[model samples]
Target chain A: MTRDAALLLPSTEPVTLIDPDGHPVPHVGHDLPDPQALVRAYAALISARRFNDQANALVRQGRLAVYPSSHGQEACQIACVQVLDDGDWLFPTYRDSAAIVARGVDPVQALTLLRGDWHSGYDPHATKVAPQATPLATHLLHAVGVAHAARLRGEPTVVMAVCGDGATSEGDFHEALNFAAVFRTPVVFFIQNNEYAISVPLARQTAAPSLAHKGIGYGVPGERVDGNDVAALLKVLGAAVARARAGEGPQLIEAHTYRVQAHTNADDPGRYRSADEVTPWLARDPIMRLETYLRGRGLLDDQDVRGYAEQAEQAAGRMRAGLGEETSADYRDLFTHVYAEPTPQLREQQALVADELSREEER
Target chain B: MSAEKLTMATALNRAMRDAMHADPTVVVFGEDVGPLGGVFRVTDGLTAEFGEQRCFDTPLAESGILGMAIGMAMNGMRPVVEMQFDAFAYPAFEQLVSHAAKMRNRTRGRVEVPLVIRVPYAGGIGGVEHHCDSSEAYYAHTPGLHVIAPSDPADAYGLLRKAIESADPVVFLEPKKLYFSRSEADLTAPVPPIGRAVVRRPGTDATLIAYGPAVPVALEAAEAAAQEGRSLQVVDLRSIVPFDDETVCAAVRSTGRAVVVAEAAGFASVSSEVVARVTERCFHSLHAPIRRVTGFDIPYPPPKLEHVHLPSVDRILDAVDELQWEYA
Candidate 1:
C-alpha cells in the first residue's frame, strides 16, 4: 500500500524513481511491468500524443474550437487504464485528453465538447465511464460514490478518478478522500500532477508537502510515482487497484508529470513558465523512456519503431475521420438536447425560430 | 390494516421498510444509520430487519452519500441517500447539478439516474445553520432534477416510492419540523399522486398554496379565515421543483387570488416561481396581487425568534387579510 504522508510529498521531499539522469534506484522496487506491456503502454501514449497533435493542427485549421494536449503526461493515464478491468469506471477532468481516450472514449467524442456542441465527451454508460467533468475536483466525490455503489452491489469494480494537481486546493478533493477512506470504498484516485492547472501551479494549490502525502489525513494509502515512468506507474497503479478491488479501500496515486505542451490551445505557458523550465521534463518524456527501455532490451528495432510511429499517424487520421462522421448541429440539434421533452416555453422558442427561417426561405 | 398511528420519524421507517420489501433494488445509506439507527433513531430496527448492507451507515461525508446514490441509480438500483441535514449537501451540489442532473441528457438519452436524495430539510428544530435552512429552491432551478417535499406521513410514503421509482434524479426534501408532528395518516390507502397538489379545503376567496412545514400553516390559516366568514381554499403542493403548475394553476384559477407560504425566505424561493406562474397563467382572475407568507429573508434566528422568521397562522391570515374577497 502507498504510505501517503507529508514526509513523502514532492515539495518537501523529491518523488522520483530513476531521476532525470536515467539512473535506477535499488530501494525503490521497480516491479517493472512486462516488456510487452511496456511496449503496449508506449504505443497507446504515442497514439494519444498523435491524436492530441492532430487535433491541435485541426484546431489551428478552424476545425475544432480548442484542444488540450496530454503531450508529456500520457504515462500515468495509459498506465492507470491498463490496471483496471472493463467493468471499472473512470472519472476524468477537462485536461485529461489521454486518460479519457484510454477509458475507451474515442478522441472524436471529446471534439463535441471542444466544438461546444455537447456537454458529454462520450456516452458514460456505454464505456462504464462518466462524462468529462469540466469542473475541477467536484467530480472526485462522484468517483468516490461510484466505488461506494460498487461496494453496495457486492461488485468488485473500482473507480479511478483522474484530475490535475491544482485541483487539490478545492474542498471537494478533501471530501472525496475522507469519504472513500471512511467508507472503505473501492476507488483509486489518480492525480495527474501535470505541474499546472491552467496557470495556478501546484505550489499555490497546497501547503501540505506532496499531493500524495496529503491523503494521510484521510487515512487513504497515498503514493507519488514517476508520471513519466510508464512501467513504475502501471505497477504501482495495478497493485493499488487490486487492493481496492479486494475491498481494502481507496488509494491516492499522484503521477508526478509535467505538461510539456500548452495547457490548452488557448493558453500561453510562456507567460508563466519559461521554455527552459519545460526542457528537463521534455528530456524525461514518457514515450521516449519506454522507447529507450525497449531498445535496450533488443525487443524492438528501427523498422519496428518506424512502424509504431506510422500506426500513431494512422490512428490520428482515423480519429479525424471519425470526427467528420459525428452528428452535426444543422442548427436544429442545438435546441433539441437541452431538455428531454422540451418545455412549452422552449418549444415555442423553437417554433419561433422555425417561423423566421420559413419567412426567410419564402423571401 | 397493518397501519398504526406513528410519529413522523416512525412513519418514515415503515415507509422505507415497506419500500425495501416491495422492491429488492431499494437501499438506504447515511451517517450512523446502521447500529446507531441514525441520530434521530428514524432508521432504528431497520438495519436489523433489512441487514446492514441494505440499511447501512456511511462515512461522515454527506457528498459521498448523495453522489453514490447517482452511481447506484445508474446501475439500476434505487438508492435513497440520506443527507444528515440540509447544509451538508452543499459540498455535493456539483455532483447533483453537473453529474446527476445532466447525466441523462449528457448521455443523449442513453442513461437515467433514478436516485432519491432525502434531506432532513428546514429549520425551527434549532440546528443553528448547517442542519437547518430550507434550500429547496436551489434544486428546483436545476433542470433534470425532480424536487418533492411532503409534510404528512401518507404523502411521505407514496411520494418517496414515486421518487424512488422515477427515472430522473429526485431531491426529496423532508421537513424536519414535521418529523415528530404525529397525526392520522393512512398507510393502506393511496393518497394523491406524488407531484399533484391536494386541495385540503375548497373555497373561492383565495388559493393558499404550501408544502412541507408550510402546509399546516396554510391549513390553519384556511380554518381561521373560515371562522372569520372568509372562504379561503388550501392547496398542499406536494412537489416543489417541476412543481405542480397544473394543480397550483387550477387552485388559483378557481379562487382568483393566491397566497404562497413556505418556511424558506421569500426571496427567489420555489414559492417565488409559484407566484410568478400563477399570476402569469391566471392574470385576469386576480382580485389582488399575489401575497406570500414566508420566512423573513434573513438567517434563521434563535429558537424563540424562529416563530418570527417562519410563516405562522397569523402571517398567512395577514396575507389573506390583505386580499379583497369578492364572494359572500
Candidate 2:
C-alpha cells in the first residue's frame, strides 16, 4: 500500500543521489544504478543537450517553426526513457522532445510537429510511443487507457506519461490520476517541475507542499528527485517503472529541475523573470553535474569526454542536414486520413481543392 | 432468420451483444453501464454475458472515460463508450475534438481511433436541463468525426453495430425518446451501409427530410398531409456527417419543394445544412424555397415547455404549408 510515513512525508529538499559539485551522495533507501548504466546515461544526457541546441539554432535559421528546449531537464528525460522496455509506451508532451528522442525516435522525426507537419513524423505503433501531445495533460489519460488495456489483455507493458508542472493543474490531469488509481493501471506519471510554466512560477501554480504530493490524494505513491541528478532520476524512475510492472499500481514523480532556456524561441523569459533568478539554475546544470560524478568515479577520462562530445556533434550535424532538405507539401493531405474511408463530402472537397490548384497552375 | 417484435432498447442491447461476441477486442464501458445495466437498461445483461473485462462500469468522469476509450482504441481495442446524457458529454469535448477525432489524421494513417461514443440525446421523456439537450450539430461541425443517429429499432441495432466495426471514430447519437418504441424486425438482417439515406415513404408531391427524433414527427405530418390530399415523401438522413446529399437532392428536385426537420435548434443546425445543399443543387427545379422545422434557438427549455420548444407534428405541417404547393 502506501510507503512508510517517513517516505510519504513532504520534504522541501529533493531526493538526490549526487550533490551539485558532482560528488555521489548516498541515498538512504534507494540503490544507485550500475556504474555502466550511469555512464551511458551521461552520454544520452550530452546528446539531448546537443540536440536541443541544434533545434534552437534551426529556429533562428528559419528552418524550424519553433522549438521547446529541455535545456536543463535532460536527466529527467533520458533517465526515465532508459528504464522502459521495448513493449512499454511513452506518452510525451510537446516539451518532452528529448524524451521522445531518447526513446529511439530520430531527432528530425521528433520535431515534425514543431516543424508544422500535418501529423507525428514517426509511426507511433512501430516505436511504441504515442504522438507528442501539444494540448496539456491530455496524454496522461491516453497513457492510462493504454496501460489499462494492456493489463486487461494480460500484457506485461507499463506506461510512462510525461507532463510539466503547469499541466498538473488541468482537469484532465486530475481525472487521469483518479482513474489510474481506481483501476490500478500500470502507469507512471513523470512531472518535470521546471520552476516556471511559461513564466508562471510554481508558487503561483499550486499551494500544495510539492507537486508529487498531488498523487497521494489519488492513492498513488509519489516520489521527488533532483531532476538534474541523472543517478537519482534513474533510481527513482526505475523504481517507479518496477512498481508499475509488478502490478502495484501507478506512481507520480516530481523531478525538481529548472528551465534554463525560454519556454520557446517565441517566448521572452525576461518579461517575467530577472537574470539573477536564472543565474543560480545555470550553476546546477544536469550535464556538468553528471560529468563531474563520472570523472570522480574514474569511469570517464578526458578522452572519453571528448569522444562523447564528438558523438553529440555528429548527431547534431546529421539532424541539421536532415531538416535542411526541403519537401513540398501535398494539398491532398487535407482530405486524406480524416477517416479510414474518405466520405463523399470529403471527396467532393478534395476535388474542389484539386480544381483550384489546377486553375492556379494554368494561370 | 428468426424475427421478433423488439423495442429499440432491446435492439441496441442485442447489437452490443453481437459485436462483443464477434470481436474480442470490442469493449463496452461507461458510468452505470455494468451492474446497473445503464439507466435505461440498454446495456442490461452485458456484463453477465461478456464478463467484467469486456463490459465494465467507469467512474463519473466523462473526459476520463472517453480519453481512456481513445487510448484503448489506439492500442488494438474497439471501445464503445457511453455518455450517460447528451449534455454530460460536454466535459469530454476536448478529448473528443482534440484527440479521438483527429488521431487518425494527426498520425497520418499510422494510428486509428476506432472509438464509438454513444450518447442518449433529445427530449420527450420529461427529462430536465442537461438530460435533454440535442447537441448533434456540435459534433457534425467537427471535421474528423462521423456523426450518426437512428430513429427506429432496426437502424438502432444495425447502425450501432456498423459504428463499432468502423475504422474511424463515430459519434452515435441515440434518440432517448424512441428507446422503448417497438418494431418487428430480424436481428440478423443485413444492415445497410453507413452514410446513406433511406426514403421511408415515396411520394411525388414534396420531400420531408428528417432524422433521429424528428423522423417520427415528420412521418406523422406526412400521414396527415396524405389525408389532406397533399402527397409527401419522407427521407431519413441516418448519417449526418457524410450526409446523403444525392438522395435528398433527388427527392427535393423531383418534388420542387422541401422541408427539413430536426429537434435541434434551427440556427446552424443539421436541418440548415440540408436546406442549404438542396437549395444549391435544386435552385431551378425548386418551385418554392426550402423550409426547416426545428427546435427554437434557445437552451433546451424545462420539461413543461419542451413540446413548445421542440418541433412537433404541427410545426412540420406548418413548414409543409409554407411551401408553394399551388405552384407545384
Candidate 2 lDDT tens digits, A1-363: 564545554456778898889987887867778999999998999899999999999999988899999999999989889999999999998988988998999888888888886569889999998999989999899999999999999999999999999999999999999899889999999999998889899999899999998887788878889999989989888989999999999999999999999999999998999999999998999988888888988989999999999999999999999999997778887788898888888899999998998999999
Each candidate's DockQ: 0.45, 0.84
Share of real contacts kept by model 1?
Answer: 0.48
Q: Lowest-scoring 10 consecutive residues by lDDT in candidate 1 chain B? A: B188-197
* Cα lDDT, model 2, residue A263: 95
Write candidate 1's Cα lDDT for A37-111 as tens digits: 877887788777787788888788777888787878877768878888999988887777667777777777766
Which residue ranges in model 2 land beyond 4 Å of their true spot? A2-12
Cα displacement (angstroms), candidate 1, residue B41, comes to 2.9
Residues B1-328 of candidate 1 have per-residue lDDT tens digits of 4565767787787778888899888888888778888777777888899887788887676666776777677766788888778888887787888878888777676767777888888987866756787888899888777788887877877788778777778898989888888888778886455557788889978889998988887888888989999898999888775566777888888888889999888889887888898888889878888999888888778776787788888888888878875452
**Model 2, residue A78: displacement in angstroms?**
0.5
Clashes of each: 1, 0
Clash number for model 1?
1
Best by TM-score: 2
Query: What clash count does candidate 2 reach?
Result: 0
Clash pairs for candidate 1: A9-A210
What would the TM-score be for candidate 1 when compared with the true structure? 0.92
